[model samples]
Target: MSGYLADKNICCGCGACENVCPTKAIAMGYDDEGFLYPSLEQTKCVDCRACERVCPVKLDANKGYPDYLKTYAGYSTKKEVMEHCTSGGFATELSQLILQKGGVVFGVRYAKDYIKAEYVCVTQEEDLKALMSSKYVQSEKKDVYQAVKKTLLTNKTVLFIGCPCDVSALKLFLGKEYENLFTCELVCMGVTSYKIAEEYKEYTEKKNKAKLTFINARSKKNGWFVPHLEERFDNGKTKLTTLFGSYYGYGFQVYNRPSCFQCRYCDKNGVADFRVGDFWGIKETDEFWNPNGVSCIFVRTERGLALLKEIEERGFKLFKTDYEKATVNNMSSLHNKAEKYVVLREKFARIYKEEGLVRACKKTESFSVKLKRMLPKGMRAFAKKIYHKLHDKKTR
Candidate 1:
């Protein structure tokens, strides 16, 4: 019964173990927090240790960070592509480049219902639109890793884009390096569950009496500095809620998988060829600063550097930038600190199960939060500042 659960709080739910299980013994099941964990079928288990071998958490423990290369702050010159993307449109540009070269590009996209995200391999340039923007929830890898291996074995170029853990798991599952495979990882903040996303959708649907057709979690509609959780309903009504004002956004930090807080991949050294994320905290005076959005790309391997050069040659805009200066305030790349609200998180989970998503959110709001909701827009800001100041002083 060699399970991958080295500890209660260690699984990243990358699905590498499930894909590698030779006898189909490992199944993914959700915990109270709605995050996935591997559940073994003891009767079917052959104890071959395939699951253990492919576990990224187990393999990455002793692995050192890869050598650093160069960093850049840039965006795509294509206006339409830049408009649809969450950041500088580097990912779309890169994916397009791979497709142009007859390579398969694997990326995360919302399922038909817009409630869950899953990895899909795109071979045509038209399908690249599905891979654009950001999906804040944790994605289901399913058997995509196996599919990727098959493509790699066929001697085809493969580009895989995912969170840091997912990329690491794919590398571990392949068990060896393949020159044809190029991996890119996001500088993740953390990931919530599919259940959480589904529940939130259900709540939104019930409130609006309409089906959810589209959601841009990092929408550029209100500009990138303060992105909105923009949702379009089947009834032709659209709702745009600021990230700070949304329950799902607030809960994302507090109710993520336990492994996320103790992440082994949130460092300058990384296992992927390229790391991509929003160039947060950029100043207007900086040369690369764009009011729209900009991406800070970190090239970690020689292969990544060459591919980046090739993309630039194809009319993609890229600018050299300092890695340390770019990422100094970028918590997504450097910090793995979890939200400090264990009891509140547990309470919210219980309330969510007993009541529903909307009620649970309302119940979890602090006194100050509730008060802000009742106040006017101007008063709300002032109230929030005072509350935070008092709370910080009290904590100190």
Candidate 2:
């Protein structure tokens, strides 16, 4: 196996190694944090080294920002589409286009009653709804890469949307680019542990005494900037919490995988043809600013530009904008430095396993975090804006 990874922390858990193993010697095993790592069955190992050869961490060494062909800030004209997507419905719109052309679309979706996220394929327009919106937790690739390979072999069109690391891993595993394949990478901020997500689900279900029927982590019910986590219960009740005041908020602050802190894909030179993310700091005076939502789209490759042109011709609302201005405040795409929450994250994971989720959260919550959570909705919103302004100024 050529020592797939010397240290587990460096693995992005993309499952490329498992997918490329010829003898099925590699299996994905979970750590305490609920992130996957490759494990080799010594008895079945043939020392082929294929797993190491396909590792994205080893292959994506010359990574940097690619010259953007074009940039845009726009949203879908369809209100219903924008309402369900995380950003400006760009992904949903693109997926619909692929489906209409009889192509396959692969993306993350909830499984096992919303406790986990995994990649699923959809070939029908009606099924595209299942792959919409953001999934904050790390998603299990689970043989989807192999499925994509098989579909490509059939000369069928395929669109794969995922975090940058997953896209890189798929590219490395395939060993070459396919003309029929299209990839879109999300501007990621990092993914939280599934263990944390599961704990939160259990706590909420127990507290409410009901099953969670539906969850929208990126709901625009209260507007895009102040997004809320909307949860629907089986008993006809609903719960709405600010995205910044929920467990997801805590994850945003800390508790992502170790590799996320030192992400190699957080640059302009990504592996995907297109990069899409929230236009975080869009100003009220900007032409694309809408209370509904807005997406910052970067066309990085010729294929991406061609797809953008096709979508534009088909009546998608896209406005060309300055690349620097479009990405000025979107730190997720440019920031490569790891956060300083490693120690705190480790402590939280240990405490979470020893105690319960609530206690672990209470133990880790800083005074400022507590204060933010305690503030009223309006005050919290105001505080968040001020915080973002200061952050942008300092980072600039």
Candidate 3:
């Protein structure tokens, strides 16, 4: 209620306040740490508390986790779709279903510059490709909530996909849920800064000697179990490297926004009707185990269940699973905090303010990571195989 919408550690920066402000008094601006915070203009402010009402972080802080109606592991039957997506392609399947019903889908995609990701509206099936993979960076919402409400008011079906905080913010902004609107929140492990995303792009382009044309943070080309970043350059070249090899991915859990470290929505009862993410711990021996990809989904509402049923009827594969096994290797999807390296994270922020992300990550990286990076490619792969073998055993 102070002049700002919420303090840095509490604000998720969903931009609902800026979108809902009647006087256009609220503007989202980046602080020294490069995360967005609401800036209020007292001159144009009506003091109506519309911004306050739309803030999910402030309103839903004390909400308890709800019991899920069901849990499942699945993937799209289409090889082409599953191969190109970050996870099982269930989100793409849902978007396709909504589009077939003459509905619009809302998801995130890189901006024209490709340095930042932002919410985009997709009404055509072909356009869904833009939203295919995961973007670890926090996306800019820029009036997207208003656009979503406007579309829903027309009585058309809409499928909105985003992180749990974003889904909650949109629901709060609408003040009520419309039957025509469906939301699917991605099970998130927090998000990094635009500054880090931008710095990584510059670093990659500088090293590759060409401007970056495209990037997929979680490409499944080499298979889903192993994470990689696929990058394309204007000079007609493409590169695929391990997730840890990428600057943005290397600093992921360590350099997330202050609010993300204390995320309140990382629970079984998320804000969205359903939650979807990689089914990381599915064993090779399981019948539903797919090397191509598999998605872990938790249905929290009847509408979510109905959507799952429809996908199953339309040839998407679904396997009944329990929450415990489904979340085995992906506990960050349900945990509230990432407390691994608080001291190092603070040092990272301080170094980043002066030297930028690439240098900061290099300075703060663990000795093990540095050693792994130094290994020969073949040796590194062998080591990774051994690590995964042990990890799979632990999870099992």
Candidate 4:
């Protein structure tokens, strides 16, 4: 353990430091299920502690939450912002606001050649769209953070967005370096291990017989909970596929980072100034086709609230709605709730072994026939809602 990344007392293992390293010396690999951390080849490291400098929990002289922040998830905004936004499109909104103030924002983007996550800058409107949605994979966002640091070090404002662990990684690496970081975190859905995203690319490339042009994880046209894989062939044909049930196995097919499945900071990880995520479990009717591109948002701090207001003030359609509150219990962590996923670790491992990472959802053979019968959209929604409600209640 030559640097801050290995510090048991402070390391959040977001992998930002590994990504930032120029030598390509550090690799992020999982321990058990899928938590992430930097594994270093000591010979390559020059003992910079560069990874430690940006850690949020480490950088904040006061990294703990305030008394008023206990068990709260809803921010001032109520309605989902964009159809494809993983949580609400609030992060983009906030980033845009900061840019309007002549600041820079850092977040993840898919590379033009590969569907993997890469760090990026949001300096203009076009750049903002790229920042939308949860990429749901491990990213090598080296350029993204470096860009933000370069701008902020010159006293420019910056709104950095990522999962809680990502935020922690960034803050830790930045240590005592910059004073103008506007850090925001996604109320994370545990990250699928890095290998999942990487393997999906490999699988799709061979399976589809085409080079993928875009792979949207949260396509509204598809189900938000289901991953929609889009493949563009050499002939220009675009096709979409779904991964509804086998996210874990598919995610682990490549190999996950060690710390993912057994995360520690989920309940009250003070990794970000504000946390955001899909406000799931909200009730709505068919008219609320707010699907396809809207996101539910939570503002977890005063800065977050102010950023939301600024976003709305700039002609973005902002709506207020009601949301359900999340508890330490009952939420399906999926990836980075960062810890407590282990009680069922064996069960998960068993399921994955049985089905692999990218299996399709269990098809309802009877419903398959019914769906092909050209059932009306309203009827389909009603039927699906009933099935989902019953299913959820039973699971509970």
- Per-model TM-score versus the true fold: 0.89, 0.94, 0.95, 0.70
Best by TM-score: 3
Model 2 residue runs over 4 Å out of place are 1-3, 337-339, 388-396
Worst 10 residues of 1 by lDDT: 387-396
lDDT of 4 by residue, 1-396 (tens): 565555543444556666667676787665543444567788887777766565544554445744213222222232344554554466766776777788877888877755456677777866777777767666665445556667877898888888766776666556553557788776554555454555566666677677666766665555543344445677577765443323322343223344444444454554566665554543344222244333445455666566656666665554554333332122533234323334344444555556644432122113443352345434554655566567556654
In the range 4-74, model 2's lDDT, one tens digit per residue, is 65257778899999998888888998886778888888778888888888888777767555777888998
- Counting clashing residue pairs in each candidate, in order, gives 0, 6, 0, 45
Q: Which ten residues in a row have the lowest lDDT in candidate 4?
A: 67-76
The alpha-carbon deviation from the true structure for residue 229 of candidate 3, after best TM-score superposition, in angstroms, is: 0.9
User: What would the per-residue lDDT of candidate 3 be over residues 1-396, giving only the tens digit for each residue?
Assistant: 333487777899999999999889999988876688888889898788888898888888788866888999999999778878888998999999999999999999988767678999999999999999988878999989999999999999999999999999999999987999999999987888877778888888899999998888888766777687789999999998777766777877578888877888876756787899999777778889888889998999988898889989999999999988888777677686646666778989898888988888889998867765677555655666577668877867
Report the alpha-carbon TM-score of model 3 versus the true structure. 0.95
lDDT by residue (1-396, candidate 1, tens digit) is 455544657788998989999888888777776777888888888878888898888888878886668989888888888788989988898898888888999999999988778899999988989889988778888899999999999998999999999998998899999999998899987788777778888878889999989988887776775556789999999987665567666566556677877888886746888999988746667788786889999999888999999989877778888877667556768777745665677787788788876687788878755654455545543544455456545533
In model 3, where do residues sit more than 4 Å from their true spots? Answer: 1-4, 375-396
> What lDDT score is found at residue 348 in candidate 3?
91
Q: How well does model 4 score by local distance difference test?
A: 0.55
State the displacement of the C-alpha of residue 136, model 1, in Å, after optimal TM-score superposition: 1.5
Off by over 4 Å in 4: 1-13, 16-37, 40-63, 67-84, 143-146, 176-179, 223-227, 245-256, 285-289, 292-294, 315-384, 387-396
